[model samples]
Target chain A: MSHADPVLEIRNVAKQYGQITALTGVNIQMFAGEIVALLGDNGAGKSTLMNIMCGALPPSSGEVLVRGEPITSLHHAQEMGIGMVYQDLALAHHLTVAENMFLGRELRSSGLAGTLGWLDSARMDRKATEEIAHLGISTLRDVRMPVRLLSGGQRQVAAIARALMWSKAALLLDEPTAALGPKQVALVLETIKTIAAKGMAVCLIAHDIPSVLAIADRLIILRRGRIVRTLPAAGQTVTSVVSMMVGENDDAAAA
Target chain B: MDRFRHPLLGGNTLWVLGLDVLLVIIFQLASANGAFLNPINVQAILTTYSQVMMLVIAQTMLLGAAQIDLSQGATAVLASVVAGTVLVSMSAGGDPGPHITLPVLFLVTIVVGLLAGVINGVLVGWLRINSLVATLGTLGIYLGTAQVITNGENLYGVPLSIQSAFGSVYLWRVPLSTLLAAVVVAVVWIQFRRGSFGTHTIAIGSSEKAAIRNGIDTRWHMVKLYSVAGALCGIAGAFDLARFTTTDIGGHGNDALAAISGAVIGGTSLFGGKVYFFGALLGALLALILQSGLVILRFPPFYQVIAIGFILILAVAIDSFRNRNEMR
Candidate 1:
């Protein structure tokens, strides 16, 4: 496939734990304004690939280029505008929504108070409100509400909002709908489309085939640490995707 | 309604305050002619526990960050011993022989405390030692060092002015040390409520992996927190020297227990990620009142220990119940 420029490019990425190889010779490229669904079973290397891309785990041998520049270290990846939303939704539940949105990168007050580590809560609240609105999330009424009080869908939105807030190049989401109800899943899926529509690269890792086929522009399938197929989402049915995922003939699996 | 439930000044502080008021009333009725309400007795209670209040503030921050320091009281004693020994030796060497002033002595004691805190911080924060075991081991070392320094005797001859200033001097009938403790509490309360440091600390306590992913230097922050705890202990040591005019080596036996219990009672969870400064202050006051009130009512002193032990268990049980509710 040809694109103007790729936002994230992984070339021949591999991961090994001593004698066991978790991933081998994986190649993938994510472009701007596209939703690429990473599909795989339990032992698949989807997590390993995502980890390497986000700098959480180093690849045994590979080159990861962000916006055409090589990057090392997770902090550098963040500085290069790559962000991830973990499956567990890494949020401090006791802190307010605004606080969680700006967890480590808090806005300090201007001048002396700021230098002394005072957070500018008003500005944070206002900014958080604007971002939530930008994402079309209306369920979260109060920016100052602690995250623990939020519903599952709202928490997922907040987590996605956090990743999108800092990620200028690409956003990686791992199992955005694993524990979510059907309604929440729809909300998250819609949010992901909105994020991609804003001209940012979105990589979604999920198992549910119908939902993945519903929102994904492209589908990348993984099996036994290898990319088995990369196909266009258009004109594809769940049966074909499942057959590809489980490496079985479509007619046999259906029978 | 939202304002009432505001996280900072809301449910926890109110509960602790209500408990404090109830205790005061009970003590008033239990004492002959309401002796527990006597101004002198009240002031004594506030002043006597002021040191523990200071220590509790430090413990609150430590416990909120999912760590504990059992060596705080021992560190205080070590700081006082180091400062007092230097002063005594300098004075014993006769006129103009490196005499140490109170300010210098105070500075020395604080430095000693900071050093001790750094050691604990490095062990727990950098070395990744289990906080309880590390601090417990340090507690023995610190206490042993203090004893060895003074040969099991008190280091006396603290300047009379220092004693009067920290002990007798009262601002509007409140001891200076108590006022100082209030200031420390206010400062800590503000940091816990409004500062990024406090937010980062709670975040670390909540999930270290999440905090790291969010770009927080968890180990560095942990080290800094332990160092701050040590510095506070040192300040408390200075106050101890000034109040009693001596560094009584073994006088701090119950301090760590009282401080930890008070912090726990104030809603600083052992599981971490939550702290209540005002609640902790009230918890310290409650312990002090219970002890002195029992004395006034002629109950055996051992009852104070029993009460404190019971309160610790009760606090933990309540915390676990609250956590369960949160999970649901």
Candidate 2:
């Protein structure tokens, strides 16, 4: 409702896996510089939606529009600048933070008629270090240390960092705080806030009601492969959101 | 030593070192003579190891990236024949062709080897064929092609000048070919240790699904990796043919198996992820030493095969345990 011009618009999207319907007539709009959390139970179409948006899966019907244009090709996905970070973090455990940050988008120096390509490690390291500092992740001190040496929280942060470094448009994070301890969850929430402040749109999927309340600017609840409700953060409580998420009547009226 | 705890050089490095120590001890025990430790014999061992070591080095790079090129040995054999036949035919038919020039011949042979590798890459990387099956198929294709070229005829009296430069020449008692092997090992080690290639390679092998989700261009990376392996085999083939002074038909039947065994013994894991180039170097050396020890022990050539099999199995077992530990 607060959107001026929606950054992403999913118009009547539907997806099916064999005989099972994963998502049905799901419609949502995401705006820039906002943290929108999708709340759902297990297999409630939360992952299906993110997968469709991230180019991991194709919708059976309808369209996904970025800046009012539908995505139809791989180049469209890359050009739209949407990035995804899965629950596994996808941070190469063998690679250093700098290497992971610039994994795909490596900058190489021009050699002999522009034929010899060499990676510019110095520049990549400097940029990765700056990004790490900006995230307020002090535990990740050595940019050269492999992600295997990193804690769960640091690995999550690094995955996000890779996304931010590669693409500037939108980030779709799936279960970003799942399996994290309380302290790590709080740190991730802070990182989410910082990401939004940088004018980047974030779509976070979570099952935890308290976590959504902590970081989300708005919440979209999906039940049985359909959008049930969209609520703003102002004047919202966990009780109301939980009832809405589970398809139960809100207690606000009786209270 | 705990001084280094890299994914590549962890407990696996210790395993490689232990194997080396064991091989040396076995060599000493089997020989029971001063000849085994003689510098001349050592140099001879180095010379012999240098040839297979080239193939092992290439195998290590591919294996590092969670790939294996079964056709590398066959490709080397084919290159040797191609270089020898083309040069001999050109010289005999007169024109002292550019193809016979050392640099040009070397480049052409490598290019031929690269073409063979590219075939495997296209099948495995582009067509998304299973690497083992794809390379296995090409292994037969390349070996068959080599046999056809030679037609069971050995090419002798190869350019003596070429032989002297690459084969007979030595710098302060060290063969130039051995120096070349040293350079290859050093370069690969730096790439794996100081560069970012190993990281990406290991990640690909560790879990292809994970690598794809992380935004890696897995297919393209694999193609490039296979090409590198091919180029190295091409070079090795050219060198082996030039040095051996004759192009023997079906000379590389055991090259692939030997290189793979050497890599495993050097602590490279077949399940992918993790590469130890120097360990591969040590592994190749151990294999060579064992062969020499067998000769000194007056064992048959068939026994050497059994020894290699045992070492390969033992090394793979140790590597698997190390892999499980690291995963935890």
Candidate 3:
């Protein structure tokens, strides 16, 4: 890695809810300019691992570090440059796309107006427009259009763009392509690739094997609350990945 | 669909405003002998409209965040009672300390309102009680508290001159209360259009979970919203004493419903995240016009209450229809 330090690192992280161990002994690193895909079946700890990494849920043990500095809370995680697009997008559908992008971190006008909490709407709209353009996303035309009006893929792009604006080290996408059409899926993959080329570490948690194979540079597969494999994705196929993910094929071969 | 813009407020304000004007014109034309347009009737409507406008302003913000406060009227009644009782004891009832009485009375009234609001906020925001139920419970408690304070009798001995000064005075042929209401509306509208609190308020109402995930302290913010509503009710209570110079302990029972009717009739959404302050003003005005015009046309006064119920239902129906069709 160019920086010699991973953008994000989770070391010996484990999570438990009562007697249910959601994740155990999870260790992962994401270097800048890298795309890491987290794959697993339902209840396999993919979501738990991602939640801990994003600092949305605390791990029972271990630490989440951004640029080697431990993150304390979700707010701290964000402050230290960990951004995430939730599975549901967590967008305020009644607000415009630009407003959602800058929600809770709005840019206010200078001087007294700012102190009084008056927003610089022009500046925010301009900033959002500039960010969208800088990301090279052409699907969304209006920043002022409420998120409720955007297509699913466009909402995904907007959420990604929002995360990108505040994130300096890593972007964690939870099922970014879930429920999108094939063409939209391709668009999202291309967008992820574009973001990775910009040197942002991307951790993609997705269920679609082929889509994961096509976009992810590395695969980390988990089963029954523990990671089973960490393999490079340069020459992996959908069938091979699927067998490893389900874990039954390995048992059959052993038998 | 394309018309929605502005970061803080949006939606069809002009459409609602237009309807308000049409309602006024129809009233002006239909009332027997144009009585609705007569200066005295007009004056009476403007005064009562201004009086309830305080609660309307409060209810607008509450409903804009998808919250409801059924105790605004009760809160006002209690505030007025406490403040009036204190003023009478302090001033010995003659003009009630002319210079200091009104200000102090108003302050005490508002603080009580604010305290009542904080209780509601704590229940809803901290304890996670449903807002409607919380406020409804507080309504009973607050009204009961006022009744207990006065032994179910309206408190007398308030200075009559308060009515002459703050309640009935006219600066430019309009009721002094009307002018004061205008100032309040103007100040609040500007803030709603440009302030962070206003933006965040809508954000929370639009989707509380989304707002919380985005780093907004939805729970804490809810406390502030309810507090503001309560404080406004305090001011309305002060107005109650100012206008009538007596505690209307039993009179303002319908204030909450009237205010909600006005706010919803305006463009503010009952589901939260949408607010148009001017639209709310117009909505309240429409209700006033409907009630007053019916009176002039010699319709039974009970029919006015029925009209209000019908109009409130119609407004919600329209809002629901628009919401269902707009969202995919």
Interface Cα RMSD per model, in Å?
A: 3.0, 4.3, 2.5
lDDT of 3 at A140: 84
Best by lDDT: 3
Superposed by TM-score, candidate 1 places the C-alpha of residue B4 at a distance from the truth, in angstroms, of 8.8
Clashing pairs in 3: none
Q: Score the docking of each candidate (DockQ).
A: 0.52, 0.31, 0.61
TM-score of 3: 0.95
lDDT of 3 by residue, B103-132 (tens): 787789889999999999999989999988
Cα TM-score of candidate 2: 0.85
- lDDT of predicted model 2: 0.77
Segments of candidate 1 deviating more than 4 angstroms: A1-3, A250-255, B1-8, B93-100
- Evaluated at residue B171, the lDDT of candidate 2 is 83
Q: Which candidate is the best by TM-score?
A: 3
For A1-255, candidate 1 gives per-residue lDDT tens digits of: 356789999999999999988999988889999999999888888988898998878889988889888779788888898989999889887677888899999998999988778889999999989998998878787988877778898899999998888878899999998888999999989999999998889998998888898999999999899999999999899888888888886447578
State the displacement of the C-alpha of residue A226, model 2, in Å, after optimal TM-score superposition. Answer: 2.8
Local distance difference test scores for all models:
0.83, 0.77, 0.85
Q: Which stretches of candidate 2 lie over 4 Å from their true place?
A: A1-5, A11-26, A41-44, A55-81, A109-116, A181-183, A197-199, A233-255, B1-33, B93-101, B156-159, B186-199, B213-215, B299-314
Q: Which of 2 and 3 is the better model by lDDT?
A: 3
